[model samples]
Target: MAKNTYKQDEILEEPFDIRHLLRASSYIKKYQKRMIIAILLSSLGGAFGYIAPMITQHALDVAIPDKNFRLLFSLVIALLALYTGSIIFVTIRSKIMVEVSQNIIYDIRKDLFEHLQKLPFQYYDDRPHGKILIRVVNYVNSVSDMLSNGLINIVLESFNLLFIVIFMFLVDVQLALVVLCGVPILTVFMIWIKNKQRKAWQAVSNKNSNLNAYLQENIVGARITQIFAREDENAQIFQDLSQDCRRTWNTAVRYSNLVWPGIDAISVCVRAAIFLFGLVIFGEGNKSLGTIVAISSYASFFWQPIMNLGNIFNNFINNIAYLERIFETMDEPVTVSDKENAKEMPTIRGEVTFDHVAFSYDETKKILKDVSFTVKPGESVALVGPTGAGKSTIVNLISRFYNVDSGRVLIDGQDISEVTIHSLRSQMGIMMQDSFIFSGTIGDNIRYGKLTASEDEIRKASRIVCADDFISRMPEGYDTEVRERGSMLSQGQKQLISFARTLLSDPSILILDEATSSIDVQTEKALQTGLNAMLQGRTSFIIAHRLSTIRGCDRIMYIDDGGIMETGSHEELMAKKGYYYKLYTAQLEEVHKTA
Candidate 1:
């Protein structure tokens, strides 16, 4: 198997941007009151946690030493009550965070999907579907834990760390200073680890995108693989992709896993040194047993938040990579947007004209050169050309799928670029060579053209396109389930359904781009008869493979090398003995050879 591999040299090494989190937070800003309450509750929990240790110090220093049983029992009850209150506060805060995070995720995903819808066709053409899907679905979810737990943890733990430091100094200044030393050391270590972890996560994300793209391609081309008997080869390639993803994911995990243990190790060393130094320097005469115990407890409490912070920081860094990918997609410029003063197209008269238009998908190659043409209302024009000769480009421009690089496309003598795209496209119908039939019943697919269409209208449209005969013969008769992309239907059947869909819209302008190329001879005659009837009194552009199909068209155009080489009726073009003549004769000879 020959595998095409690209270098994964772009590694993420930038420091996590606070602005990313700030932007994400903006979505949930409406719930600020609830978030504030949650943070307060978390702060309350941290404050309550100090009670148990304080009660212990008191019991050991005074109550037990003085043999006061009643005081000891009272302190025990206070200890239990304080710890229970802390648990309740944490539980309530977790609930609030969960709700806020879920709503924020929903808003973000909705915005992403809506933005993708508004993006130009060229945007989708340049990127794989799998990468876009990953950003919308997987990347949005990756930020959930960070938004939910990471946020509340950062606030509450900072307060907890502050309170612990204050109490440590109050207990013993020397021990407090020893505890503070671990802060800088751990902070430096985390900063170093963060850089490595970010790169690892970026690699993992890239690998996942590659794997998704590969899987999607293989699934769509499964039939081709089977036909070529290359299943084993393809499977090997998939295995390689999966292994690469797993390897990168493990690297990220390895770096993240180092965070907690490193924090805990420093914590242990700090505590050990505090105890040893306190005893060695300030003997038993200076520091009381209760004071030593209290200081040790305070030291652990101080380091505990730092340890928890280490875990939260790991999730924060991991999701930052996901946020970068997500925001990058969101920031994609919508190049083809309507002007601020764009007008809504009124009832269309369907007189389309292109004046000296030129277009190039890229700088190196031009798809359409300086071309000019006009189709009067109700005119049926057939565009006949060899492959890659700009026949489809002309139709695409009329529909405003791609704006012309130079010159103007006008409908009813009004520039299309000055009209709202939705209003302009509403009155037009386009059917491509590959008919896209989504998953649904036959009737439902037809009704998609006009959602307000009644059942009778659907059946009538099907009958007009000659699809009703085959549809009625099915087991369910217009109710038959068409699998995804209409896989269950023959090529002819899909084309008929597509025709039915287009015709049901009652469009003023219709485009058929090689629609009957894949259809059989018998189906083509039936389709042509129906189409010729429907095309009456409507502006139509037909791209035909069989030259014989365009004889009835009002005019025939022979396009070559991005220019119109010849234009006339079939009889006139044949009489001229030009490019159209040669093309028609070549096609006719080929048909005779097949016969």
Candidate 2:
């Protein structure tokens, strides 16, 4: 089996940032009325919870001693009212928060998607799709519980704790002080447990992202694994990844386990202390059985809020890591956004130039250096070279897919950076070597180029690329469904559809990057006739490895090592016996050997 090449997950070690939490909460501001109402209802419900114990103490102390059946019945009825009100308040609060949480989540997801659309190509090139997917979908969900219930619980429970403490003091100061002492101990324990669990949850999140990335990569390359009969080997690799995720998840679960038990133990110890202390007071006649019972009730009530608050706080800490991940994506600066004063470009005449342009995907390794070139309006130019010879880079620069690191790329005497990207790209059509065909009908995909394109124009474009022939032969003709990535179609058919889509856009500057590489000889011949007609009165750049495909171009340029090695018409370069001549002859010899 090949060694596992995936890198280990990078566990984030930074301390939790409160700013991310604050920013996440800011989304709720727009739902202010709903949140306020929820908080009010929840608080009122919690206040009603204290009434039952008061009634219990009253019945045992005052009504029983007096033997007042009427007073006992009245107390029972009041207790029922309190319980009923509490339930109603809780129900109403839950309904409001549910809608509030959903709306906030919807807004966040929408903003993230809109931001992704504006990010430059290089941003996507550097990150895995699954990692980004988790931030936008899964991570957002991780924070939902905390956002929906955390704030409401904190508000209602804090009020309950305050009221419980005050009520206990009213009943008996001695027992109240004892209960308060246990709080500091619980606070110290909470801090220690919370910190440990935060780190553990972060580790779990990292492993989850790693597992997602691995799964996505394997699924996309499932065909390659099957072709090589390496299914067992790949399964073993996946098992290792799954085991790593499981181990991290267990670690997080262990930390969570420690939290509630520790709080429960503190509650038990406080109760024991309260009971023992109450006996001494009862012997001294300073507190009656009813007063002691009421004090104990308040002590239990006190721990209820403390336990609840601890759980809410723990959830918030756990969710901080996910919030940070989400905000990190939002914080990424758009490297290629349009200038504030950028103007919408007028319909271009399609003259393109690169003036001493240099570019590097990274600072350490340059892809193109000090390269200069020009393509006049309506000229058809073919760039031919071996792989890694910068032919594709030149075309990319012309289309502004990647901005030049140094120097300028100009179209019709205007720097590309000076114009709005939308207006500029709308007039330029780029069909990459591996075109992406979205899931839709054949006619729908064609109309994707120009959404308002008429059916007549769609058919005309398809006929111009020779795609209409096979398209018409399909069972549903143009209405046939092209499944995900056009997976159901042959390579040649997908490329032809891509061409038809590009042609329908009516671009002033057309870029075909190895566009015809997939078609067979007969299809290529038919495509060439249509391509020749399409090339007239529009500037076009073709990047090709096949020498025969570009023979009719107005000029052929041989590129190597980030520079133009030779430039001339095909016949001129053949006569010169230069780099182009050798490269073309080598391909011709290879063709004859295959024949």
- Backbone clash numbers for all candidates listed: 0, 0
Best by TM-score: 2
Clashing pairs in 1: none
CA displacement after TM-score superposition, residue 256 of candidate 1 (Å): 2.4
Score each candidate by Cα lDDT.
0.84, 0.84
Summing lDDT over every window of 10 consecutive residues in candidate 2, give the lowest-scoring window.
1-10
Off by over 4 Å in 2: 1-6, 64-67, 144-148, 280-289
Instruction: List model 2 lDDT by residue over 415-455, tens digit each.
Output: 99889988999998888878778998999998897999998
Model 1 residue 499 lDDT score: 92
Clash pairs of candidate 2? none
Which residue runs of candidate 1 sit more than 4 Å off their true CA positions? Answer: 1-12, 15-25, 144-149, 285-290, 308-321, 473-476
- My TM-score estimates for the predictions, one after another, are 0.92, 0.94
lDDT for model 1, on a 0 to 1 scale?
A: 0.84
